[model samples]
Target: MAPLLICDNRAEVERERFVPGTPEFRRASLALFIASFLTFANIYITQPLLPLLVDEFDITPAVSSLTVSLTIFALGFALLIFGPVSDAVGRRPVMFWTMALAVLPALLAPLVSSINQLLLIRIAQGLLLAGLPSVAMAYLGEEFSPRALGLAVGLYISGNSIGGMSGRVISGMVAEAYSWRASFLVMGIIGLVGVILFYLLLPPSAHFKPAPAGLRKGLQDIGEHLRNGSLLKAYSIAFVIMFSFVGIFNYITFRLSGPPYNLSPAAVGWLFLTYSAGTISSTVSGRFIDLAGNRVAVILGVLIALGGVLITLLPALWAIVLGLLFFCFGFFAVHAAASAWANRQARRARASAMGLYLLFYYVGGSFGSTGLGFLWHARGWPGVTAGIIFMLALGLLLGLTLRDKD
Candidate 1:
């Protein structure tokens, strides 16, 4: 038997075989985007609510953040399991089951009367959600045309930004108006709807070949990816960039609510609209990366984000918002470049590589956000800004160091 090969140019492969913009491809991409958005939204819903949770649970700022931290931790770790499982099983079935499982926890979360229970459910939710991202990337690698893959991936990421923004905005407002429990219920319903749409629309993979399942093979694949210098640099870039991004947001509410700013919850909710800038930047940057290459685009993105952080130092409220918009724009641009670079660098087991990248990404969010909460607690916004600046510097270094081998 001939060794099966996953083609890099999915568009040409499909054109030689299947019709372009066929009902199947359109449905699959749309369904996957919806599901991706819902999963990501649920993961980030707690971000804007950290202050509320601190007051409600009567916990320290760091502890209160565990509601989000633990979820990302579980998500980061679960990628190891999900990546290989999708390779051994198949993308559609794994995605369907994982997404269905995710809905249950969101519903169950509102029923939990205690913070501990909520935390437990969130961990379970993170583990299940992990199945989607890694498998989704692998699906694109196997199914899309190389020329078109960048756009498809960018759209999926745009769904992530939209979901993240919606989750924070809606949850913050609902928590202010009703109770936090209501926020959970609303997201739960959204998850259920996403699941239905995903089932109805996601087309079956025509090109996937299941790997032979064994622990040794899985470990070897993972080790091979880790050994690649460029891939390792991409992973580090993801870690530092996400760490800086989440750390800033984790404490921004605390700053606004307490001091000279003293903004209301609804007012704070409006602030997350800055994420819209991220959605636009990701799409534009994706096209830019294809044209200019990852190194230049990523370096420019880091500088933009670093400048945005400096804007927050201004005492004026409008300046702060402007700063946030720039920060989000830079973050998304850098993220789009780095993620695409990872996909292109891995010659085989691309799903595992992407999963590893996300593991570092979210773990950076978890630890960086929680650990930096203390900086805000001790020295206020200055301390938090200083921490983020350090991360951005490291990210810039990594971006500059990136090299492609022909």
Candidate 2:
């Protein structure tokens, strides 16, 4: 009798599931995408401002790199706390408050009188901003149907790609026109608007089940996940890919704006529009991954990105632009596939798995950018490309080893 009742319950659950291509699914997917875009844009708005920061603070390239690196590091650390808290409390409440508070740092950044104060606020901003990324994956994992998950994840990542691009473009343009301080003010205003929209649009989760265990169980789950070889490889891929991506962009603005190019900030801002290629690629890859296997998509993405790195070695301006476009496209393709794959791979403590993935991801960005500054100084773009090529080669090797049997 008990077995029959369990079967009946499972059948009922399947009956109530939402199908793909429905209006409700589309609405939910779009809202999640917007949320992702705003969250990531707020996080990365400072990328193009590194050079401006150096000029304003009279700091060296390495020191100026901290303006972005510190934020990523804080974001990584904050996830450790935020992910577990979300599991206890629920996703929406934590996300709402944390995103709201994230705006405060952006508002405060322009008013800071010292570089130390600005860096402090940026760190705080990264910490607060982590709430969205840490929880959004959990939300998708619990809410979207398996058939719809790929589309939903792709849309969210599309938001990330668009946000990252626009953030850099807008900040660079605004700073060029006025002051670097103006850039933060704009980001704060946009973030406030996004917060309002997110609250209004995102529906409550239908499938969230609170973990039965306390903090000890959560900690043990994290330990178990870290010990899993496949999961560890995924985390490593994220770290290396993000490290190479951020490291290059962290200093590229400075490099382009000085010396041979002497490009204005507005022109530099336009370069970020190349991220549209990433946006498109991410969405396309999302559908492809759903059709093909993750391993194939990931391997192809690595190759494409590697090709982009090679292209950047050419001294011509056109070659650089073409390289950036391919770089952005390949990055999004890999990221969208890997992010969804992480959720699929983790049977328990999915949020924690994603949190750890992001932790390594951002830490890689922080250390990669700062550490590679010396390489940039010593050997220029050639040195940077050489390092990225090595990292991508390793990523491809790992991608080949990934088993998608599940």
Candidate 3:
């Protein structure tokens, strides 16, 4: 028997979702896109600064990496709380306050006298970062007409690509010219601007019905989704993709900033322009996914990503950048396809399924960004690359094992 979809109003929930080319649809998409932009930008802006942090704080490369890792780790747990809370209260209120409150910590980050104090602020910022991603998907699920959803989602994801690239470029440049503290200040300003625009643009939720806000109910709901074999595969895929991607980006900066390459921080930041390749690949991959089937796309993406990892092992700067471009391309493609696959398997339980996917995603990233530091310390960049490739291979194998009916 199929599980029931809980909602406050059946008629409202069952109504045809939003269609493309409408004014209201644009507003919703733009708002969500901006939300994605701010969250990703702020969270990852620290990537290029890892080397700078080691010098400033007199910390080891591994310890300096925690700024990104800890931020991502907090985001995972926060998703568990906000997903159910948004179900009960409302999406806009939760999203709005999360964005607003997150800004304060960013603003305060520059004021922190100790590294621990900065980490505390990052934790709070990461927690609030949760309000958008899962809820935004839920919002799109309710609001978009099925035919228009792909484009709507594409736009939202585009923001993430551009935001991540711009954040690193801007922060790294600012840190180079001034100080790393100034980089945080710039990121905080950008975040503030994003919140204002999001508040003014987003439409109120009409189909959103408050589910009962209870921890027990949310846990039970998540448990039910976990029982589905296909859903579990979707989750494991997410875990590996994020784990491999974060670990690579975290250490690449360290490698490039060292001896032979001797790149400046801004130069390291420029390399992230490869993320735009992801933006392009994600869009193109989406078109092929409906025809090629999700599994085929996922397997190819993992293989492509792994190939990129291998290219980075070469001793050429241009080759490294080219590798990263391919890596980002594969990352975005598989993510778009795999996420859609998971939601399809979950059927009516879309929100909970998304929450689980995100939970795995960040948990993977947190560990990837932090845990791989030991390998980096022991065996250099080659060790980190070996670890990431192993994870990618596992993900590819899991992708192959997924049956349509599972």
Whose TM-score is greatest here?
2
lDDT of 1 by residue, 55-122 (tens): 88887778878888899899999988888888889888888998898988988887887789989999
> For candidate 3, what is the TM-score?
0.94
Prediction-by-prediction clash tally: 3, 0, 4
Which residue segments of model 3 deviate by more than 4 Å?
Answer: 1-16, 404-406
| Residue 200 in candidate 2, Cα distance off native in Å | 0.6
Angstrom error of the Cα, residue 81, model 1: value is 0.5
> Which candidate, 2 or 3, has the higher TM-score?
2
Worst 10 residues of 3 by lDDT: 1-10
For residue 273, model 3's alpha carbon misses the true position, in angstroms, by: 0.7
lDDT of 3 by residue, 141-229 (tens): 77776556556666776777888888899988998999888998988998999999999999998878777879798988898888988
Tens-place lDDT per residue, model 2, 1-406, is: 9999999998777544444667657666777777777777777787777777778889888887887889889999988778887887788887888989998989888899878998899899889988988888888878777877787788888998898889888988898999889999998999899888888887787777777547787788789889988788888888888988898787678778888999887788778888898899988997899999788888999889988889988888899889989988898888887778888898888778889888888898888878889889999878888888888898899888888885
Candidate with maximal lDDT: 3
Worst 10 residues of 1 by lDDT: 1-10
